[model samples]
Target: MSVTAQCPRPESRALRENHPVMGADWGPFNVIDTAKQDWARGWAALKKFTEREAHARVPYEHKEGAYPLGQWVAEQRRAYGAGQLAGLRARRLEKLGMVWSLADERFQKNLEAAKAYYDQHWTLCAPRTETALDKPVRQWLSNLRRPGALDDHPEWKTAPEAVDKDWNPSWPADWQRHYAALRERVRDEDGPADVLPGFTVHGMDSCRS
Candidate 1:
């Protein structure tokens, strides 16, 4: 006769079965997985924004369907700058035309406003209260002209200079505006320009010498 030998289950397995610690009520939670899902959701929102705007330079206060996409973008930039962003994620954002530096983005926007002002007036000597492209052009120029304002980004000066060589003239901006008006009048008129005291053109007094 052949006898069959039965092996007893491990004590730990019996304990686990009795305690039911690994039942459906207790499931594993992965924080990394949750964070990845959140990141993917933000990326989707950003992708949609880029599809519509053709760029990922989201404003600081922008939102996409209740998601703070701009804040997410800013956080990504910070992580990238700190070398904490994953390489794949950075590449994906770069592919979408992400503007990493807010300062550079702001400068480009202001430069566009300056260009528009020059196009309209043929000069960049706008008054302090002047606005162009919904931006405070004169105030932006004043800020750029402050001492050491562009110390870290000296190359920014060349952009405005390219738009107008005398953008940052040694003479007063008001004087430049008057000179521009006078030149325009001379060009438009057929005879020698007659300049008398108290004469005004383009709302500027020609008598103020």
Candidate 2:
């Protein structure tokens, strides 16, 4: 599973400072959060094919309030490869794409659920400290950032690191050194309890929820 295409540009806080759009982007999103409002717009676009106004629709709602990630992933692969779909010539393709979009919505739901679950469990196991931390905990956070890491674990790929590097200052050299040293210390203290847990195990367990 490979993720191609560039991530969308992040909206500036200055542009969003006092005014934010209001509507259900998706989820339990409050109309107040600028980012969430943006997401809601995206969610609405994906949902267009399913709306009653559309010429076609698919019964793609997931039961758990989240779309099936594996299903969404499969459809996406089809869309990207020799199986690209569009218009009347590709009615099946367009329909599947709509379902895929619903699957995406479901994925978002799962994301929120997983984040909440981890946040709750995280607060339980240990206090937030600069020193020692749980390997599982780190993996959980990492999985949230990159869902595909669970199966592929693509370390070679680099994603957009800074939200706006030109506008925002990069981490200081000393800060990087401190961070690396902090991780090393935490790993050493963690002993052999899988000092570095990958997304595989934790991610699988999370989806079960």
Candidate 3:
């Protein structure tokens, strides 16, 4: 049985006030995935990397690469802010660099691949500011290593796969078989087999705690 509990929504003001970076400008980081899967995945990867590095939920706008990382740096440097990691020692960029280096080997590989993906797919922002795509891969990786307060977001990024909203999971046949076996219990001695299934019964009690 599920409890119909009324919990706070993601749009709650208390939460929003706590997350000062949520409303930052998306600016000109227009990506080319018309389907938006690339944007979703890239953001997810960025969030995952942040969580693993700091063991907390870091927030940022979905303005592709530059905006989010820069936002993260600013919040982290407060050193005592809610977003900053506990007991943070190194200076902002140095600490960020150490975290970048500490990422799992697989994360590093995926981040590199994401850099290529962005290079090929991302379109230049209108009134194009800089030729970010022209930056070499080494420079791309280096930027993430040591960031400054106003530094542009790092390159070589990736994200988790976007979810398929239209997909629905059907009941498995194995589960149906197990349910049928349990239904057979009605005929054994405890209940009537002819009775229609309903919420009236909770079934045989488990032997284990």
Candidate 4:
């Protein structure tokens, strides 16, 4: 009777531990995919906002649903400024008419308001307390007159000038207001109107020399 030697079978095992190969880990890939998805979602929300508002100058506190779209826009501007934004992403934002600088956008918006005020009143000498299109027209004008306000953006000065050549007159705003009132009265009378001293038109003493 040959006794068969019961040999314990060697345990089946890998030649090495299951260590991930270099650059083959899915952890980094998953993180990148998640970031890309988040970005795409933000882009979609911004596209909708631009389509409805006709602009991408979203307020910093604004949001779309639960998404902080305005914050995303600000991030994009920061990234672009730092040269970290991908070219394709920048182009996509530009196509949506994104305004990278809120300051510049505000200036343009105020300029439009100034133009509208001029169209209705025929002058840009609005009172300091006056508002046009919900904008502080006089205050904005006052800011524009500050030294070096337009040094870096000289082209902006031309827009107000085109709206009204005397928008930034050398004369005082009060004087211009009185003069405009007097001129309107003269035109209505179709000749020289007898505007006596202390007489007021639209709250302005137009007859005052």
Across residues 19-103, which tens digit of lDDT does each residue of candidate 4 receive? Answer: 3553355345334577889889989999999999998888889998889998999999999888899689888999999887777
Order by TM-score, highest first:
4, 1, 2, 3
Candidate 4: lDDT of 17? 22
lDDT per model vs. reference: 0.83, 0.37, 0.38, 0.82
Higher-scoring candidate on lDDT, 2 or 4: 4
Query: Which ranges in model 1 have alpha carbons more than 4 Å from their true place?
Result: 1-38, 49-71, 83-88, 184-201, 205-208
TM-score to true structure, per model: 0.66, 0.21, 0.16, 0.66
Model 3: lDDT to the true structure: 0.38
lDDT of 3 by residue, 92-191 (tens): 3343343333234434554545345334322111111222334343333334335361234233222311211111114442343234334444547654
lDDT of 1: 0.83
Q: lDDT (0-100) at residue 111 of candidate 4? A: 90
TM-score, candidate 1, is 0.66
Largest lDDT belongs to which candidate?
1
Q: C-alpha displacement of 157 in model 3, angstroms?
A: 14
What lDDT does candidate 2 reach at residue 190?
42
- Model 2 lDDT per residue over 29-119, tens place: 3335886464344344445534634533333343213444344434444665555644452444355354434545644444444344434
